[model samples]
Target: MPQFDSDPVFCSLLQGSSDSRGSFSIDMMDYSHSEQSYIRNSPVLVTVLHDKYGNSAQITDFAPRFKQYGRVFCPVMTIRQIKPLNGSPRICVRLRPIYEYGAAIPQITHGSNHVRYVGPDMILRLTTNYSINAILDEIPVVLDEGVTLILGPDETVPDSVTEVGQQFLNQTLDYWHDWTRSLAIPYEWQQEVIRAAITLKLNAFEDTGAIIAAMTTSIPESPDSGRNWDYRYCWLRDGYFVVSTLNRLGTTQTMEKYIRYLINISANSENNFLWPVYRINGMRNMEEQIVESLAGYRSMGPVRVGNQAAEQIQNDVYGDAILATAHVFFDERLEKPGDEVLFRILENLGEKAIEVYDKPDAGPWEFRATKRVHTYSSVMCWAACDRLARIAHHLGLDNRYEYWNSQAKDMHKLIYERSWNEKLNSFVGSFDGNELDASLLLLNELDFLEKNDPKFASTVDAIGEHLKEGNFLFRYIAKDDFGEPEYAFTICTFWYIDALTSLGRKQEARELFEELLSCANHLGLMSEHINPEDREMWGNYPQTYSMVGIINSAIRLSTSWSDAL
Candidate 1:
């Protein structure tokens, strides 16, 4: 039996195959698309097999059966010998490309000492290693005679394509391994963080280096509702967290590339007054369009592409961008003085923060219908001003230090008083509403209050009691108009981890942190939410913000634990 250090779920799914010689364990997981049938119709079949000989087999029968073990069914596919090899048997499996319209058959091929295949609509070539051939050759010999078998409605490809699919799966595993090995996370949760971190990076669009909010989009926030939205674009508010996390992990290359992307987008935008919340390839004209022609995930209506929030006023973004840039400057350990362009950018942001810090804007959530003075937004505004002041002081730039400092102080003071709901004994979501926000947990890290401060401690307890669900935490209580979302924000859990560490509850913090880490999928990847009931990953895959949380929490836990020891 071959051992796999990656994606055990996939490994187990592929291990189900039986041969005349008994059963052999292949490395792969089979993920059903039925749960999310709207976005994709076909299930995903992944496996790792050894193919020493060029000879391989094709998929002959494919079926899915739902059992008591799990909500989703097991995928069964038959394989037939296509050719015989003198050396080792080849490994392979088949997959149907599930899209909105229907399924599409994909062609499989081999090249460059590996297997290569292309689905008609695939954006990139799928490749795999030679080891998978052995798995392909061991399929039940009865199924190897090219017999047709029952397949699901969503299934389009025949069993003959199994070899190609196996090839791609093997290649994918190799690609993931190579990518994971390249990352250098020195934190104590290095192994765990590295796995999650690599997944986040893989989800990034290679050409633009823009990390998508998640991997698969349109996973309904509600059941069979029109709540699905594409999360495949970049969000400025998340950029700082992503970059800072990568920096802490010593993976600066991708973050640097992302910084360049940010610079280009910010520099070239025609309407700086309205910074888009997301854009594809830095294009600001991101119009929200529904693919009415195709079904949504789980038959959820109106699968949307492009985010309308792109045009909304998210003032926190300005602060997040500045904070990320500052972190890059600080973490890179730059010895030289700050560049003129970078300094100018900071100065402009400081000026903007000073001007808009008092104004009510659509807060971080970008609530479409309401515009209020959200406390989290105010905090970030304060952060932007505070960071600028520190940068100016550090570089000895004789800019408006007094003005920036005064502005930051005023913002802080406002949040302390106006943003607090004294009656509830917790910080409110906004000045207009009494809802508590999990984002307030960021106060300690932002230095708004010491971790042990009575107010901060109370706030933490308040969030734990009001906003937490088991080990997971929601972003905030649902507003009257906005329905409650299904997924727990992964980053918020990490924030809680950081908060715990800051409060000197290192053991508790480490335990909670480990629990959160365990929420990741078999590949060490996380989505926006982990279904509390089933604990399966929901929302997008490979979320950068979630990975950022993993990295930062690990850093805090390791550093603090080491110091205590």
Candidate 2:
């Protein structure tokens, strides 16, 4: 995506607060939003200590879901206290909510028990289990921990905070444990697979099944790189892989939601033409803009909202869109199982692919200053045709199948002639040059080349030799708009591991996969890139692509059920 900023704005929402530790007001925006501001009553946690001898410890304060029930089903936050060796502690709580994307702070009317936050758009009723006087008047009490605090209209709460917190934690633990048990995970590398699965599930907007590229935006790809681009939208290219991965895990819920989104966009687009990205709700018109109101992550300037890549022409989406939809035709359980109608709609995208795949447009990297027929983009175009043919054959449309198959064969032949670099003895990144891109490593995964093919093996070696930096891989070492990428692209590194395992380098691949898994944040989450030199996460948080890579690699490399058992 180009780093430009000029577009209409749709505001994003969140709630933030301030406390004694510096100021949560301006502090946590470290890599979060800075442009928008709001104020409302949110929960506050104050740990008050009542000493054994009436010498109470000083209370320190600070603070912090999906909609489900008739009332908002917000997150059930839990506070756990490890048994303190020293002081007896009590808990104090408060509630505040922000209004209008942080632009306007809400007014609070303190009540005997609850507080009603008067916001510009809507009214919020915040209920508390503690004494309103203690919360509002700064009174403190020592309480136990591990209690799950549920904030609803009229619910009973425990006097011992620990009891509630622990119950909440227990329920949450059991909830996720049950969910994971439903997953078709490999017996081996179970932990790594589960972590990746959790991340992937989190990345999807459950309400709409739209999988976002990452949670936070403007996290620099490299330190002070100014390459902060917002990735809070659905990219067809990314969505394709997300659907495929979820399908591999036997989870079709997201696939159905996402395709409904895709179909909406397809029908709305002019003549099946598509932008690379769209908002989760299938909003097509995104105006990229700068949020000067908030400081950028780590003080990087010009924090941006709305991605400009949505405007770029990334042709690989044709294959992506089709591949994502292929399941619809075959899956009987889906609401609108694939029919002639959907196939016709998808054909328009395939036709658009054939029209543009050979033409010059933004490739997957979306390099504006330079454009070329990216090998990956072309292969996806080929993939679109290939998948359409398969779907047609499956549906008993003999003529359509024959036509798509023939077209796919022709496109494949042309790509081989153009993208294959005889001199390098491997496929190159773009038709115009010889730069080795890690994306070319996807050749086997895409089935463009057979797994055992000598050509595919050579490409793996070519990309590995050139792109590997210790255990991580860069998208490409060649510099672009901002200059050479200083960090390793986390997804690409995982892709490298997948490539290694595919080429029969199981031991080496396994070692690298373990290293990549180690690079995740404490929560087993990963950002877009990594500072390979220091193993620090860079770019956006909990990137879907990186998490998908982890899942796919583990599944590919895990031992057979018999062996694992």
Candidate 3:
């Protein structure tokens, strides 16, 4: 690792392993909540240093978790001795903290088993059973299984760290295993579905019920592609799919939490327009920027931290936000049922949709260079009004239902008339355009069109012919400022599976779906993009949308429970 001590902090998983080291990232002013990867680097490090013979011990590191306490998640690293002899073994610890997105390295002081590091951004405390001098000096001292370290905002260090750590590790596993038991996983692909659900669950900020898009930033969509973006913030469009998948798997808790988040955003909006993305804490501003100090993943320059797209008008958000809350309006289990207040707020969004449905926008694909009246955005706008009409009907608000339904119908007519291209034999990407966009694959999904509709079949074929590269799919094949897309967007491929299943092309869909599953990492985790050629996973990791696709496709295609045996 390049030990440039200034603008960035270098980190590693194994305490003493230099080759395994990586750099830290944060949501710079431009890339809001950018460092969605791992939590900040630990100011406390512990490693075993062995003398000449090179015989030493090993330490296991993990955050203390499982049973949910009100506010206690102490990361504990347990060091244990292995079978070793003929050498003087020692352990080394270090405390170097770069805070404020690598702009500041904090001042440190120690007391007993604790070290306090204070910076302008935040305060951190390291609690361990080692000497402060040894930690700062980077000298490895001999250690054993009982050694332990925990870091947190609070300075309180428990008396018996080893005992408490062991207890935490045991209970945490039991807690997770027990929770996993409650999943309503499909008989087939049960393990895969459960794992995806667990990952998605981790993505939710329980404090606010906000589900982030992913947990990393500045990892390029492709090598040196300049498509590196912060996936930490929550986007209403992506969150809608995530909520639907969770709700389908009988995990209504996340949906319930996300619905409340939706209501809160709507209540606070100055205009009826809903932002496509927001910080998990519900703070609205997300100005994106690039961090100059840190060399990016693989030392790629121009690592970005924030996401500026939060300000851009992506019209699909209104529909998604409304659809996100549709569950509570019908599910009697809700504590506070949807009322006229919510309907009125939705109507405000519906009006905004009608006003902007025909206007140009950044659209769901978030094209950076130019705006277009994307067919997908218009269809989603139609969905917003259409769902509002359904909710209004459910609430017995007949007038509201008629009003929203009329608006939805008009938008529907406008969309088909302008988007369909006779010559291309498919619905184009935008009004009066001839480009095929995979997002149009969502037509049947949004119920804008039925699978049996000849038009739907033709459009699917058109996208398959042009936008697909082997089994994987692209958002669109067109070139942009960065150049043509280098890999397949994994979620679009899932959308294709949904369409094929709906069309009763189960064999084709299953083959492709199986291939997609095989593309996941060894742990069955997926990201936003896939290198279709090499079948390597790329983009931000633990992608909620991609996992949502897995859960949804499995549900749509899994066999009867008897086969699970």
Quote each prediction's TM-score. 0.71, 0.82, 0.86
Q: Please list the residue runs of candidate 1 whose C-alpha ends up more than 4 Å from where it truly belongs after superposition.
A: 1-187, 274-276, 332-337, 480-482, 559-565
Q: Name model 2 segments beyond 4 Å from true.
A: 1-87, 90-103, 117-119, 122-125, 131-141, 144-175, 331-336
- Using lDDT, rank the candidates from best to worst: 3, 2, 1
Report the lDDT tens digits of candidate 1 across residue range 1-565.
0001101111111111221111122211221111111001112232222233333333311123223253322333232223222233332333222222222323545343333334343321222222334323333321223322222222344333445444433444454555556665554766677655655565455455566676545666555545666676778777677777776666676676677777777677554443746554777666777755445554555656667887787777768777877765566453443465686766676666666766787787777888888888778878988888777676666565666787788888877888777878877778756888888888888777877788887788888888888888888767634577666777888888888788888898888898988887655667776666666766655676787788788877785444656
TM-score of candidate 1 relative to the true fold: 0.71
- Segments in model 3 whose C-alpha atoms lie over 4 Å from true places: 1-61, 64-96, 130-134, 141-143, 562-565
CA lDDT for candidate 2? 0.70
Work out how many backbone clashes candidate 3 has. Answer: 18
State which candidate has the highest TM-score: 3
Higher TM-score: candidate 1 or 3? 3
Model 3 has an lDDT value of 0.74
* Candidate 3 local lDDT, 451-501, one digit each (tens): 999999999999999989988999998987688999999999999999999
Ranked candidates (TM-score, high to low): 3, 2, 1
Angstrom error at residue 33, model 3: 34
